[model samples]
Target: MTITINRLLLRADTADGPYGTDIVFEKGLFILRVENTHGKSTCINSIAYALGMEMALGQVTSKPPFPPSLLKNIQNENGTEIPVISSYVMLEVSNDRGQTCTLKREILGADAESIITVYESDIESISNNGRNLFIHLEGDTSRELGFYYWLAEFISWDLPLVPNNSGRESPLYPVLLFPLFFVEQKKGWSSIQATTPFHLQIIQARKRAFEFLMDMDINETVNSKAKNKKLIDDVQEKWKQIYTQLESVAIRLDGKAQGVKDAPAATFDPFKLDILIEHQGNWQSLTSALIGLRADLTQHVKASQPQVAEQKNESLLSKIRELNNIVLQEDSKYEFLLNEISFVKNQITATEVRIENLVDDKRKYEDLKKVKSFSILDDLPVLNNECPTCGREYSDHNVEIECSDDLMTLEESLEFIKSQITTFKSVLNSYKMQLDIKKIELSKLEKQIDKHGADISRLKTELYSERNVLDEESLREKIRLENQITEYEKGLVAVGDFRSTFDILHNQYKHLISLRRNFPEHGFSQKDINKLDGLKTKVVKYLSEFGFSSFDPQLLEISQDTYLPTREGFDLGFDTSASDGIRIIWSYLISLFSLREIFKTNHPGILIFDEPRQQEANKFSFTGLLKGASDAAKSGQIIFATSEEEDVLKGALEGFKYTLHSYSPSEGKILRKLNKGA
Candidate 1:
């Protein structure tokens, strides 16, 4: 599957930041051309970071390979640091099937570790509408179902949890595939993977990733061998654990195996153990010694045991029974106290609620009395010669009625409700006090329960103390010997089982190792050789175009072992100039992207190179580099950040479909400046 990033948006929540910074790219060559020391690296790295590819930026072994802050400070006229608060990066991309997603990640905040959010929508919907219009996949935000793994799955990358050389399994994350896609300005120009050699897992992971991207048939073979090695190491560790436990027990026995040096003599050799057991007399001796110990243990058990007098035994039994009954009754009381506390709390809540209602009613009545005199005027009936309700002439009916008596009665009722509210408040306070007292009593019961538990423990230990004193030394020795003998026998069986398993695994391991040792000479088919030949021709052509003509084409070759270019069958280090070395790297990278048709690879079909002008690269050679990028852009997208002028960019991008995002000191930056009001 091919991934094409349509747009990248970065926003900073600060007055002195680029709040609405956005960069747009089409499916062709794009240049984020800026002046030297401008924000080119920042912008390119932010794009990769947003895609969960930050580990590809700098030294992978660094504590944090990427910058901690995505936002850069912009100086105001007054010269003060206006910090960016909430910073985030959002990338909108689409696959070959036209399925699109927007991956958003917060660059700042306490929840940054858990801040990845994926939205399933087209780029237009995401840009024209808002984030809420899209659908979020289920469980995407959970750590167990990571967003990185989701993206890897979407792109059809086979990421397995493989064990590294250190005997620990590490997840082959998406960043393992990013070394080919991104080039950091700092160390990316130095080496293929600027990492420590001690990091064997990372090195192996890099090779696996490269093989995956290049569509090599040996990728699965390499992974299988690594996993096999890991399994063997795990089994060996298990065997070692069993051996150490047996050795510990063997060293404590009174025999030739009574010391560390002598313990290994008891080490069971699975292959020859049965033969030795019949001829050598160790097992027979161990059996005889165990029989003697058990016989002695029986006699000691009978002789050392003492009989208690009848009177004392009865007294002790009676006391224990009494204490047991008291404990049961106290446990019942403790449960009752817990229930009582819960009931008291419920009663307090009800009383408080009742008081609140009473207060509300009193307040409403007070407001009613305050507005009553004025409301009475508005409510008075108008005198007329007609009855208002029946619409008949009022010839003899009395039309006037007074509400002064009713108002007086309403005022008296308000006063009564006010008194009721005060009474409810007093009752509520009394119930609260009672609840507090019950809580104190509950605390005291808990302490008493704990004290009684300690007493019971002491009495039980005393009851067992005399019986346990019956020649514990001899009994313990007997038990230890028996356990040791049993464990030694099991150890022998385990060793036999392991030997059987290891033999099969060892055969497979040797086969894989032999294949890997002779892989470069015999592994490749004729078709694979033809593709590598094509790749070599392309690499030489690109290198010559990039102004590296000092070396002959025959002298420069690609290493079949590493798939990297070498000079005279050696690595291209110390023999080539800095400029020539970078050119070779450029040629190799461009050729990998250009020859995808021959390999049927999953290269993502995109390239991002940050600042090709580093190491004082000649402008003419740099133009050649840009020309190669433009050529590769014909098949895939090539996006690079450069510090060249507009004239240079225009000349390099003459015969291709491309876009130039120019950044200058005066034109603000990719990030828009905040207005005065903002």
Candidate 2:
């Protein structure tokens, strides 16, 4: 991608007349040379401002970066100050495909500072015809109406989404990239990417920006790794949920599942698991106990009958009849309790669903509140329940009676929903408690009915015959054994139904494990390695030529982990001298331009420097930087604004071909009053 700034026009409408400056840039190297305090930096800042990139210079604010000359007042050619009414900056830029567009922004006017008008034509054709785009608003980097979104497309750049510090994904905004190409005078010289906005919460933004500009494959690799890790996490979460559910079911059936792991494993065996129930104070496998109980029950049924005593026969028959009546009444009560429990369970489910829906609605309202905080749509009537077309208050369609004077605002509505959720949750807990009580009562009733039936069976056996009467103790033993058998059979059925789901859970766990193993162990692809190695070579070469004197220039290396300059596994910031630090910046930035020659990059092919020579570097070293920049300019454009003396500047540029825009002492300033025709 390529971005070439063709022209910059800064205009201020004052009481006397219009006051501004118009400068046209040509291909290759261009130098803006002027005396101190001559508005050189102003011209540079105007270009960035018009492009909606001033956030790269410093903290964003409503105020513009321009001085009073273009904002509050402007001095005429006669040195008389005039009041300024309004001011705006315009910049015309073209891409590698020769598609030209002019960007205009208001500094002091009725329009908000976030607004930028993009004219499809060149600077000369900029009139009232253009599309208005906004910056500094939410979604400004990814949405259609955002200035950066349009700018990226114009430069043919497909911006990638990168991870942010909050563990969420955000687009790599143009502001982060501008620090590389447009180095402001105040803070850009301090370090490499000194003005990168950390407030945006991008994780390792400096490193990510370098990777993007160089078009490294590491970005794709990182994204892939994150996605795979998320899948694995999701799978593990599901496994835990299923395991908990199985445990709950076992507990409800008065049995416990054994040998089942709670976490996902590649070698899990579902058939190894066992469901155990306590029978007569001893824990036994549910399936084995059911078989034993059935055998005992069959033996009891086939055993020979005993003769009954002649005098006790009537009493036995009477007792059996009474026990049967009791069992029938208990059975009827049990059925009614079952119906009540079912009704409560359904109600609990419906209440839970309603709570979920309310929670979702509350989340949406919270997001809407955040959007309103940006004040982007402050003028929209819908926010206040007023019709936009007719400018009338909207009626509450949900109101069924006379409307109340009080209406719930968004905050109130959120609070109301929260309270509703709390109340419903309390109600749900109450329902659960009631259900537990009913289940316990039902279990007791079942035991009572079983006891009564056992009594009746024992009494009936006692009345079998006068000659073959069964002893009362023996008859009671047979009835007790039969009841235990019936209960064991019921438990077996419940456990069997639960065991059927284990196969599906086990398969899902194994599939997730397989997917996890398929991902690459490391994130660095071969292409990423090549780019870093190539970048390291260029940086070392540039450092050597630029007189890097902090240590052995050959020992200086670019770190693979952070992509920053380092020496012997430590950063080179505090150890390097001030002058050498400046040289490092020069080498690092220029090497980016050099890398573009060999590798395809997203760099805009444009480099701007407010002052290249900082920290009083020797003339030879400065000359080496100029020579390096001149070589880089062969493929793109590089602009430098300097206060260096004419003779000294000329000596450094003696052998380099460049464009010079000079402002002498007599020229006074870069901004001047203009005539209507001029």
Candidate 3:
């Protein structure tokens, strides 16, 4: 059964379509639609609402994203109150069973029980043997549903067909057509991604075509001579640069010590240093044992009557003791220096590299999508006897040519730059690696240096006290400093940890910059910012080609930070600064295209358009779309609601026939809805 909207009611001032309407049908097709000004679109919208076609009926209302302080304040000029609520749409539907259904819907204030509610009119059985079925909107009506129930009704033969329902009514026929064909509009032009590898079928063709072009160009100039000159000049220049840089480095190398911030004292352990003093005492004791052994040897020599020489034995003993002392002192000094140097060097290097990487990241982000031009690129031919622009007869006018591209040009430049930076970074990284080693070295130095301060102070105190034996005070100070050094060495493990509290952020950064995707074959491409600048130049070039003025070219700019051009910018839209009528035409086209896309993907063959000729200015642009839709509707059904100028509709819908219907509370102007099928 076919169902359609017939009429609607609304206050004169509202843009929300109609508040109430009728359900009228004839034969099997819905007939007699009233425009929104006449309150029809709103009415049918209600039916669309009942059928779950729209997210909501009436306008979509949202709170302002910002406070009023951010907005312009306009006071009421006449102190007149605007209606708080928007108007609504009422629809009339009837099927083959002669069952007529009226649906009414509207947006309610937030305080209202429901954002939207449906109201169904009582079933008015139009024929015998029809069962009452006005229970579609709900099992029962309440205030929550608002005034919808009272405003709508079903009047058809099927209303009384069921047993124990109301009464029985006659049968009604089914509906035939409601075919929909929407018009599409064009917008801005955009280039598609085309640099993708040529598909297998077209790769060789592209290669051959470019090679031929290059060879033809080569014929115009002597490339071989230029290559020879470049090679000669490059080697000569490289050697000259190397010799000068080496000389410059020799002259500039500064051996003067760096300005030292006093390496803070490395507090040390007297207890450990004193172990050396204990070893000396052991040496002294050994010397006494040697003395005793020598006495015994002297007595034995005396008894052996001048067989042994005492002076020779004493000299050998002294030499052995001196060698032992030399080895131990050198080894102790080497151990101390290693710990001191490692820490400071690492800290300085890491800080510097971090600064450089951030500097490199100032220019950033865009979403990459597959380019749409891949198909066209693949289909382009390699060898052609005729012109590429037109399929034409072969002529002897053009010459054949072959060429080769310098593959090394791009690849070599990238490789060279990457290698230089990578090598420089490696040197810098070594400096960083030495940092921890330096930290440990520095701590050892501090411990060594701390004892000197104590000794100096002890000497000063002894001198102040007028003590004759300053050595005693020096010994006591050394012990105190040594105890402190032992404490510091114990804490070395914790102090040597160079890691800052940033492991988590490091993990995330690793993901962003270095995580390699599995699909490396798909590859990645980076366009130079200079390339975008080049594109801008080309945009100006094109605009000039189109006769745009030099001072104010009518070309669009695209930027990552701010994008101003949209799909509808080039060929359509109110935003395009087009004529009002043109704007409406564009808007209508877009709407039709969108509707078609949606319905084509999922069939809900219905349309509910309002203000097709909006704000009076859209009349001219909207005229064509309306006419097209009307023409398509001859084989189907479409319900358009508008408060448009009547002359415009008459002009656009000139050939189509529509039942004229009107609505009003004023007596003698009433056109109540009727169910023709019943």
Candidate 4:
């Protein structure tokens, strides 16, 4: 895949002033040159921000290369600065398929919230086009529609959903692709492949990115194994829980607690429990005996009569009726109190809303008063000699009229409005307080009503006690029989649950074991080995061309274990000088870029080098690096930023195919004055 940046726009808002820059690129090498601290890194990072791949820049400090920090504290005249209120990065990009898109992302001051917008347009018509017909990508880290996710798909990188070290699944984001594309000025010199020290997890992601780019299919197996392990652990925990509950149930039924039996070794067999139950006749006998006892107890209850005789009394019944009437009256009062409380609550809600509106109105008027008032003189009506009131031509002295000086100003009007809003808020708050007091009174009334209800219930119970005619011994006998029947039924239920628990555990255990055996261990295949060998050869070739002298090409090897270049079959990454380390990075990444075409890879065909010569002292090797990059330009796009002198660069690569945007302290910086036409 080939992606070319046609234009980049950065718009900034600062307290002192607003300024921005626009750079246009063609199909060739582009060098953005400036002195140190002149915003070269800022220009490169603007592209990453517009693409929503800011995380690829690694950890950001309070300086440039981090788009947010650069925008928040923009530079101004005489080394002064101002806080930025808003900032945006826009880019017009085209792909190998001839599809053109204008992408933009905006940030509001220091806040992290950003709006990502993209517009797909025709390449021929894009120069005069504004990004009006754009779509905003929405969602979060886990969503498929997020800005980063959409960009990855738009570039046709078929990144799969893989499991992280935490056993959580995440989609492949654009940051994962940065190791082979972006070279950070700070950490890019630390390794053959640029690394981020954000966490150990990102280290693992680096390995995953390499594996994915090589077209290895083992990630699916790895993800499946992770998911299977988590499922098995959860199932085992559930089995332990069920065993404990089953033991408690057995003990409650007057049976000795037995340890849960082992799961069956075969497939889940629901009939196994049925065969066991048939062999044990105790359960059947217990069920039969409980049923017969229940029938006898029912008949005895039906034939029994009251042990003591009662004499009817009209006066006692009348007193019971009077107590019942008091209960009904108390219930009515309780319902009324509840309704009144609800009504008061609604009234409070309305009053609070009114107060909120008034407060907002007051704030608006106060803000309006602080702003500078518009001058009426700037847009005064155009007057001519025929503008006389009677439609007759008149002289300037005759048409002259005096304006009043005592008119009310907007500030005075705003002050009156503010006072009225304050007064309305005060009245609304007073109403809310009054409603709260009413709610409190209603609560006390409800408590009193409950006490009256309890008194009525006690009276009814006392009246019923007087009417009870059964002997105490007979009541005790009936209660004992009922308790016996309940215990028998509970025992039967416990026996049934014991068998059911065993069946469910047996089924779940068998299913989990089967799933575990089906997932095989994932290892690299022959195709992976062949790709690694090809990458190693390319690395050796490019390293030699880039002027690295220490290691032999035959002895130089790419570590399959580390996916990093090794010297003499040993890890020499830390032993090498910083300049050599950068050379290794250059060779390693450009080899990947070359192999992408050989392997038909999805690399987006763009590489960014902020300052490859930052730590190197030798200018000769740096020129060779530039020469190699120019040769690779036939395959993709390379955007390089440097502080090296122009004449030296011209002499080093005399026939180099590239473009230059050089700047100096007196000539102005990369971030130029804002365009008034934009």
Residue ranges of candidate 3 with Cα displaced over 4 Å? 1-416, 421-577, 580-600, 614-622, 634-637, 657-678
Each candidate structure's TM-score, on Cα atoms with residue i matched to residue i, is 0.58, 0.68, 0.33, 0.60
State the lDDT at 163 in candidate 1. Answer: 51
| Model 3: number of backbone collisions | 53
Q: Which TM-score value belongs to model 1?
A: 0.58
Model 1, span 254-335: residue lDDT tens: 2212112211222333343221111122323334555555565566556544335443344445656776787787788778
Model 2: what TM-score?
Answer: 0.68
RMSD of each: 32.3, 21.2, 23.7, 27.5
On lDDT, who's better, 1 or 2?
2
Better of 3 and 4 by lDDT: 4
For each candidate, how many residue pairs have backbone atoms clashing (under 3 Å)? Answer: 0, 6, 53, 0
**Candidate 4 or 1, higher TM-score:** 4
lDDT of 1: 0.63
Each prediction's whole-model lDDT (CA) = 0.63, 0.80, 0.32, 0.64
Candidate order by TM-score, decreasing, is: 2, 4, 1, 3
Q: Estimate candidate 2's alpha-carbon lDDT, on a 0 to 1 scale.
A: 0.80
Instruction: Kindly list the per-residue Cα lDDT of model 3 for residues 450-523, writing each as its tens digit.
Output: 64444445444444453233245324534544553343333222122211212222333334333322223212
Q: After aligning candidate 1 to the native by TM-score, how far in Å is the CA of 580 from where it should be? A: 1.1
Off by over 4 Å in 2: 60-63, 74-83, 243-262, 272-279, 283-522
The superposed Cα distance between candidate 3 and the true structure at residue 199, in angstroms, equals 41
